[model samples]
Target: MGMAAVIYMILSFYISNKRLRYYYRFVSLLAAYGLIMSGTRGAMIVPLGGVAMFILLNKNTRYIVGGAICLLFIYVFFAQTHILDSNRQIHRMRTAFHPEKDASYLVRKANQKRLAEYMVHKPFGEGVGLAGMEGRRFSRRFTTDIPTDSHYVNIWVQFGIVGLCLHIAILLFVIGYSAYLIMFRIQNRELKGMLIAMNCGLWGIMLSAYGNNFFWQYPTGYIVYIFQTFLVLGKSYDKELAEQTKLEPI
Candidate 1:
């Protein structure tokens, strides 16, 4: 799926004369559906959030309103049809805030706590792949099976606090730099929209990382790098545009 999205993005970039924007939108929507079908809640939100960002950033009031209504209707219909249980959604939402008291949430907290304690002494982490080994070992010791799913926690377990901090710093830098470019460098409406969409997608990954180890996992990890590379390329594009603009006669 990640590879497909990257290919779609590259195609969108190269297809300059066609309605590439629409193509990109459709591809992103398809990716979102794939994430949903995967049953991974964390990955599922990226496309929805990306669309919302696209609407918001483009100032497309009609589409924004329509998307909101559609989302609300879907939620209501799912709840009414019992395709999705309102109670579970509510419980999970509440658990996010009161994680210590929620069973699944508590397990995540416990793992985070244990990992943090271990990192305090080793600071650099046990090394990559160590977290998975530790998780398996711990599960055996406790005679219970619960695997770690958090990118932040996994990084800490694998590379220690330092690696986690470095990873977070890179994410923050990408978001901050992208915002700067959009605000100060980009003037073309179409280009601005693309940058905003890309930023929103990155934001979705950032949000999802809190709950899933997608940052370093197969397929998703490569996708994250591709997204980051896109941002870097955007920066370079913006710089060229700036230079061109400066050289143009006033």
Candidate 2:
């Protein structure tokens, strides 16, 4: 999956003028579909979030109307009809907001509370391995017997609030910097479209990380890091463009 994404990005760079726009859109849709099939509700957010960002940034009226219709159809088919199991969809929606009331939510809450209590005096955190070991040792501390694996909670427990804050700052910086580049520096439609998709993908994954700890773990983590690297690259591209524009005679 990661390799496919990289290939898609490289292709985006070399695509011809006529086909370039379609290529990025196709890749974005494919990525979104893959995330949805992953069956982790959190993972599904990536594509939808990316599409949302695309629509907002582009502001093309026809695309906006089309997106609205598609969203309506999705809500009807997935949320209204029982084809996708109305009850499960309802539960997922409810869990999105009041995760604390849901079983998994309660377990995470309990683990976080316990971890926070444990970290008060030890500001640097209990060290990385210690928290994982403690999760197993205090398996009984949570409502569920399963081990805690939430990235939000895990990072806090392992790095304390200080490390967590630094992590958050980096994310904020990426997001802000990406937006700045897209808005100000990128004028090429193909590159702009790719960056927009990347930005949305990052946002979706980051939002999903609130529930799962995929940000620094396997496949998803690696994908997110690569996407971030692309954002930085986009910024560099913008700088080059600015320099070129300056050299052109007005």
Candidate 3:
């Protein structure tokens, strides 16, 4: 995924090895080009959301202000002006800003509404496998009737409002705790920066899961889990880095 490549680029910037860092940067550029050619709107959120998180984590007044200006420019570019509409890729991305007019988005929303009404009675959901098409092999009930376009929506359909709330709470806790550690517990500047980059990448993927089903899917799942694990275990990393630093000659 381009998000992975972007994370690599960000991490590479913090690498002390100049030649290796440059090599990674070159590879990241090629990977970014591939991402652009793919025309995936969700992938676009990686840079947008990741940059926002990066700014927030930095807590630097000047960088924060600059990031805000950049975000505003992006909003104007994608949501307001038609300057880049001539480009096919940009046109497809702009549609994400106007979900109200997008037929596919409307259908997904309609499906959520339908599921909401059906879920009024089934607080615990129909069953486990009944969320998406996985239930087709298990049961043919009301839960299986509608297509759950997003991972969150799919869980809501399968587990009902209660399970949905629990799922979200766990996710919030993981993200919250990891962020706190990164802000205060980590000591190695290089390791901290790399971890921050990974956190931003994972954050973007988590946010995008609202409109996608890749949270638990292949490739992306491994990246997400590994990043979150590293973030949560940041204190352990800090301890090791501290020891390693102690052994180095001044």
Candidate 4:
């Protein structure tokens, strides 16, 4: 789920030839399938978010318009329709739109409320690993007894409001910086496309994290860190490639 956009973004952007592009297109579609099958509601939206960013950042107005129209149709037809009415995975994802009707959502909400009341006394939190699964594994604490479903909630419980603010600040900075690079600095189409995709992918993960503790979870966490590195170093990669291109004619 976390890696879906990473794979699709990289494959979709590094198109140097028709055959390669065709291959990427095929694999990217497959990644989309993997997202749907993963059954993680929040993760499934990452690809579409990445695609939206790709189109919006594209230099071509025609592509932007066409892509927007295509998205509208998909939302109206598939998301709003009962085409996959019988598919449990699809049904679960649809629950995202109606949290009031979602059992899991209600449970998470109740858990969040309980945690909030508990936090009124401990402003600095109970400290990391003292709550949630880590807390249970290591020892018992007041927080350990409480259930937290969201990653953000986990952070809040462990680090308190201060930690949560700092965490959010860091994320906003990365996302903002990435957008700045794509819109103003990056000249290479491939790099720009990949960065856009990564930005959207990160957004998906963050938004979904409200329901699932994914930031520190396996695969998703690893993929996110790697993509962050890729995004931050993208400018360096561009410079190095440019130098290589200049030397190629020598």
Top model number, TM-score: 3
Candidate 2 residue 90 Cα shift, in angstroms, is 10
Which of the two candidates, 1 or 2, achieves a greater lDDT against the reference?
2
RMSD list, candidates in order: 6.1, 5.5, 2.0, 2.4
**Candidate 2 stretches greater than 4 Å from native:** 1-33, 64-83, 86-101, 133-146, 239-250
Off by over 4 Å in 4: 2-14
- Clash pairs for candidate 2: 151-213
Q: Which has the greatest lDDT? A: 3
RMSD of 4: 2.4
TM-score of each: 0.65, 0.70, 0.91, 0.87
Off by over 4 Å in 3: 60-66
Candidate 4 lDDT tens digits, 42-137: 665555565576575567777678768866875775557777768897777676656677788788788788888889877777787876765798
> Residue by residue across 95-183, what tens digits does model 2's lDDT show?
44445556866776777677666678866665564455445554433222334466666676667778878888999799778888887
Give the lDDT of residue 152 in candidate 3.
Answer: 89
TM-score of predicted structure 2: 0.70
Global CA lDDT computed for model 1: 0.61
Per-residue C-alpha lDDT of model 1 across residues 115-178, encoded as one tens digit per residue: 5555688778765566654466444432123356677777776677788789899888987787
* Model 2 CA lDDT for position 244: 85
